[model samples]
Target: MTNEKKKNTITWIALVLLTILSWKFSESLSGKMGLMVVILASITKFFGVSLQFLELKKAHSFWKFGLLGFLVIFYFLVFLFFS
Candidate 1:
């Protein structure tokens, strides 16, 4: 496979693993770890969606970066809410 395809596959695999691990250990894990996992998963999902959209539309850099920033802030808010 091409390098880009390989990278995307790996990223998807990692996202799935993180999602499962976060769910599995959420109750037993420390609060901080749980929060971190949730944040990471959220960020991963956000980037995955944003990149896919950008690729499809050949979107401008500003929009991609703006979406990323929004995702980061959204994750922060989610963490705070859970905490």
Candidate 2:
């Protein structure tokens, strides 16, 4: 398989795992824990994508970081509003 296809597959798998983990233990986990998870995941994903962009010499690093920031903010707002 091509590198792009492999990367896409890995991304999909990561998303699926995140969704499943959230769905399975969301009730049992405290709001704070959920928020923490979201924050950590966002940061990790941001760094991962940033590194990939740097390694691949992509021109959209800024855009990717902006989206990541937006997601982090959105997640924080949701956590605050719900909790």
Candidate 3:
């Protein structure tokens, strides 16, 4: 297979696995650890989507880092104030 197709297939598999794992965590985990796990999983999936599906991997460094910074700040704020 082509390299690009291979990369996409791997990413898609990872996304599916992460989704299933997150759902399992929802059922088994609890409290702060659970919240952290969920958030990490969500952000991981978000990153994958942004990179692979949203086509952000080729984005300018400024926009890329800016989005990453925003995501970090958002995660901290939500975790800090809400949990």
Highest lDDT, which number? Answer: 3
Over 4 Å off, model 2: 38-59
Instruction: Judge candidate 1 at residue 75 and give its lDDT.
Output: 80
2 versus 3: better lDDT goes to: 3
In order, the Cα lDDT scores of the candidates are: 0.72, 0.64, 0.87
Candidate 1, backbone clash total:
0
After superposition on all C-alphas, the RMSD of every candidate to the true structure, in Å, is 2.7, 4.4, 1.2
Candidate 3 lDDT, 1-83, residue by residue in tens: 99878888999999999999999997899888888988899889889888877778899988888987799889988889858
TM, every model: 0.71, 0.60, 0.89
**Candidates sorted by TM-score, descending order?**
3, 1, 2
- Give the residue spans of candidate 3 off by over 4 A: none
**Per-residue lDDT of 66 in model 2:** 73
Considering lDDT, where higher is better, how would the candidates rank from best to worst? 3, 1, 2
